[model samples]
Target: MFQKVEYSGTKAQQYETLLFQVKALTDGEPNLIANLANASSLLNQFLNDINWVGFYLKDGDKDELVLGPFHGLPACVRIPFHKGVCGKAANTKTTQRIANVHEFPGHIACDAASNSEIVIPLISNGELIGVLDIDSPKFERFDDEDQHFLEKLVNILENTIN
Candidate 1:
C-alpha cells in the first residue's frame, strides 16, 4: 500500500523523502514494469506543476524510444533516438532539462500544454534502459534542484528495476 507524501521543508528535503518513499514502494519487487508503474505514480503524486510523467524505453535493437508507463494525457508513441528531448537524453545518456520546449529545436510536442521538460537517462550495467521524462505547463518550472532530485529518483529506479 502507498501513502501520500506530506512534503515539508526545503525542496531538497522533500525530494529526499520522495526517494525514500520510492525505495519503500519498489523494494523487493523484481518486476520492472511494476516498479516503473509505481514509480511514475509516486512521482505524479509528489511533483507539482507537472502535466506529464513517464518512461520511454529503448526498444531492443532499435534506434527509437517506445512509450512505457506514464501519468498524463496520451503521448507520442514513438520517438526516434535523434529527434526530441527524450531522444537526446537517450542518445547522450544524460539529463536534459529544458525551460521552454518551444525554444528547443526539433522538440517533439507530444503535448502542446507542456512548456518545460526534464528527461533523465536510465542506465544499468553499462546498458541503456530508457529515460524518465517529466513535463510541466509553466515555463522554467524545473530548476537545478528538480534535476538533482529527479536524477536521484532515476538512480533508485535503475538500481531496483533490474
Candidate 2:
C-alpha cells in the first residue's frame, strides 16, 4: 500500500521536506534501482504542480539515456546524447532549468502540457550516468531555491544510485 505523504508549507519548503525524505529513504540502500524508484516517487508526490518527475538512465554503452524509474504520464524511453533537454543535461553533465519550454531550442514535446522544466544530470565516478527530469505546466514554476534543493537531492541520488 502506497501512503500519500503530505507536505505542509510553501512550495519550496514542501520540496525541501520531500528532498530530505528522499535522502533518508535512499540512505544506506545497496540497490540502485530501489533508491531511484523512491527518489522518483518523492519527486512525483511532493512536486504537486509538476506534470513529470522521473529519470533517464544511461544506456549499456554509456552513450545514451534510456528510460528508468518514473511517476507520471508516459515519457520518452530513449534519448540520444544532446538531443533534447534530458539529453542536453546528460551530454553536458549539468543542470538545465527552462522557464518556458517553447523558448528552448530543440525542445521535445513529449507532453504538450509542459511549460517549464528542470533537468539534472547524475554523475558517478566522474562520468555522466543519467538525468532527473521534472516538468511543470506552469511557466517559471521552478526558481533558484528549487535549483538548489534539487541539486542537493541529486547529490543524494548520485551517492545512492552509484
Candidate 3:
C-alpha cells in the first residue's frame, strides 16, 4: 500500500515538494533506465494540462537521441541532435521551453495535441546524458517557474544516475 500526496501551496512550493520526491525515489538507484522511467512516471502524475512526459536519451555512439520510458501516445523514437526541442536541448546543453510547438522551426510532432513543450538537458559530470521532455495540450502551459523547478529536478536526476 502507498500514500497519495496532495500537492499544495504556490507553484514553486509544489515543485519543490516534487523535487524532494524525485530525490527520494532515486536516492540509491544506480540503474539509469529505471531511474529515468520512474522520473517520467512521477512527472506524469504531478503535472496537468500535459499530453506527454518522457525522456530522450543520448545515444553515445550516434549523433542522436533515443526515446526512453514515456507516458503518452506513441512518439518519435529517435531525434537527431539539433533537430527539434529535445535535440536542441541536447545540442545546446540548455533548456528549451516552447510556448507554441507549431511555431518552432522544425518541430517534431510526436503527438499532434501537444501545443507547448519543455525540455531539460540532463548532464552528469559535464557529460550530456539526455533530456527530460514534457508536453502540454494548451499553449504556454509551462512558465519560468516551471522551468526553474524542472531544472532543479533534473539536477537531482544527474546526481542519482549511474
Candidate 4:
C-alpha cells in the first residue's frame, strides 16, 4: 500500500524518500516508459505548487524533444532543440530555471497558467537523453534549493535509466 505523508518533511528527508520510491519502482525493471512515469510521479510528490512534472525525450536524429511521461495539462508534443525552455536546456546541456516565463527567450507557453519553470537535462554516460521539466503557476516559485534538490534527484536516475 502507498502511504502518504505531509509535505512538512525536511528537504533531505523528502528527497531520500523520493529516491527510495524511485528505487522501489525501477528495481530490476528495464522499461523506459515505466521509469519515466515513476520519475514524473516522484517529482510531483516532492515539489510544491507544480503545475507540470515530466520529461521531454530527445529525438537524436531530429534534434528535438518530444513530450514523454507528464503529470499535468496537455503539453507541446514536439519541440525543436532550439526552442522553448526544454529545448534550451537540451541544447546547452544545462539546467534552466526561470522565475518568469515571459522573460525566457523563446518560451513556449503550452499552458498559459504556467509562470515559472525548471528543466534539468537527463544525461547518461555523458550523453544527453532527455530533460526533467517542472512548471509552476506562481512567480519565483522555485529557488536554489529546488535546483539543488532536483539535481540530486536526477543523479539518482542516472544509474537507473542510463
Candidate 5:
C-alpha cells in the first residue's frame, strides 16, 4: 500500500525520503512504462517551481529518443542526438542542468513558459536507455543538490528497468 508522505527536513533529507519511496514503488515492478509512469508522478508531486517532469526512452531502431511518461504539458515526441537539452544528455550520456533555456544553443521549446531545464541520461549496463527531463518556469531552478538527488532517483528507475 502506498501512502502520501509529508517530508520535513533539509532538502537533502527530503530527497533521501524520495529515494526510499522510489525503491518501494519500483522494487517489484518489471514493466518499464509502468515504473516510469509512477516515477514521473512521484517527481511531479514532490518538486516545486517545475512545469514538467518526464522520461524519454531511446528508440530501439535508431539514434533518437521517444517520449515516455510525463506529468505536464505535451512535449516534443522525438529528439535526435545532440539537438536539445534532452538530446545532449542522451547523446553525451551526461546530465545537463541549464540555468536558462533561452541561453542554450539549439534549444527546443515545447513550452514557452519554461525557463530552465535539466536532463539526466539513464544508462543501464553501459547502454543508453533514455533520459529524465524536468523543466521549470523559474531560472536556475535546478542546482547541484537537485542534480545529485535526481540522479539517485534515476538510479532507482534504471535498476528496475534494466
Candidate 6:
C-alpha cells in the first residue's frame, strides 16, 4: 500500500522521496501494466498543477506509440514517431520539456487545458521501451529540475518494469 506524499521538503528532496515511493510501489511486480498504472497514480498524487500523467508505449514492430495506463482525461490514442511532443521524445530518446504547448509546432491537443508538458523517453539496454508523459495547466510548469528527477523516475521504472 502507498502512503500519502508529503510535500514538505526541498524540491530535490521531494523527488528523492517520490523516487523511493515509486520503487517501493512497483517492487517485485512483474506485470508491466500494473506497474505503469501504479506509477501514473503515484505521479498524479505527488505532483501539483498537473492535469495528466501517463505512459505511451512503443507498439512492437511499429513506429507509433499506443496509449498505456494513465491518470487523467482521455488522451490521443496513437502517436506516431516524430509527430507530437510524445513522438518527438520517443524519436530522440530525450526528455521534452515544453513551456508552452501552444507554441510547439505539431503539438497534439489532447487536453485544451494543458498549457505545458514533459515527456521522458524510457530506455533500457539501449532499446526504447516507451515514454512517461505529464501535462500541467500552467505555462512553464516544468523545468530542468523536473526533467532531472523525472529521468531518474524513468530509470527506476526501466529497471523494474522488465
RMSD of each: 1.0, 1.6, 1.1, 1.5, 1.2, 1.2
In the range 11-88, model 4's lDDT, one tens digit per residue, is: 777777777778788888877778888889877777788999999898876889988999999999999999999999
lDDT by residue (1-162, candidate 1, tens digit) is 556767899988889888998899789998888889988998999999999999999999898999999999999999999999999999999899999999999999989999999999999998889999999999999999899889988888898855
Q: Write the per-residue lDDT of candidate 3 for residues 113-144, one digit (tens) a residue.
A: 99999999999888889999999999999999
Candidates in order have lDDT scores of 0.92, 0.87, 0.91, 0.87, 0.93, 0.92
Give per-residue CA lDDT, model 6, range 29-119, as digits (tens).
Answer: 8887888898899899989999999999999979999999999999999999979899999999989999999999999999999999999
Q: Report lDDT (Cα) of residue 60, candidate 4.
A: 71
The residue pairs found clashing in candidate 1 are none
**Which ranking of candidates, highest TM-score first?**
1, 5, 3, 6, 4, 2
Q: Residue by residue across 18-94, what tens digits does model 2's lDDT show?
A: 87788778878978788888888878877768988888999978678999999878988889886888988988898
Give the better candidate number (3 or 6) by lDDT: 6
Return the TM-score for candidate 6, rounded to 2 decimals: 0.95
Which regions of candidate 2 deviate over 4 angstroms?
A: 10-12
Q: In model 3, what are the clashing residue pairs, if there are any?
A: none
Name the lDDT of candidate 3. Answer: 0.91
Runs off by more than 4 Å, candidate 5: 1-4
The lDDT leader among the candidates is 5
Give one clash count per candidate, in the order shown. Answer: 0, 0, 0, 0, 0, 0
Worst 10 residues of 4 by lDDT: 1-10
Over the stretch 67-129, how does candidate 5's per-residue lDDT look in tens digits?
999999988999998699999999899999999999999999999999999999998898999
Q: What TM-score would you give candidate 2 relative to the actual structure?
A: 0.92
Candidate 2, pairs of clashing residues: none
Error of 1 at 105 (Å): 0.9
TM-scores of the models, in the given order?
0.96, 0.92, 0.96, 0.92, 0.96, 0.95
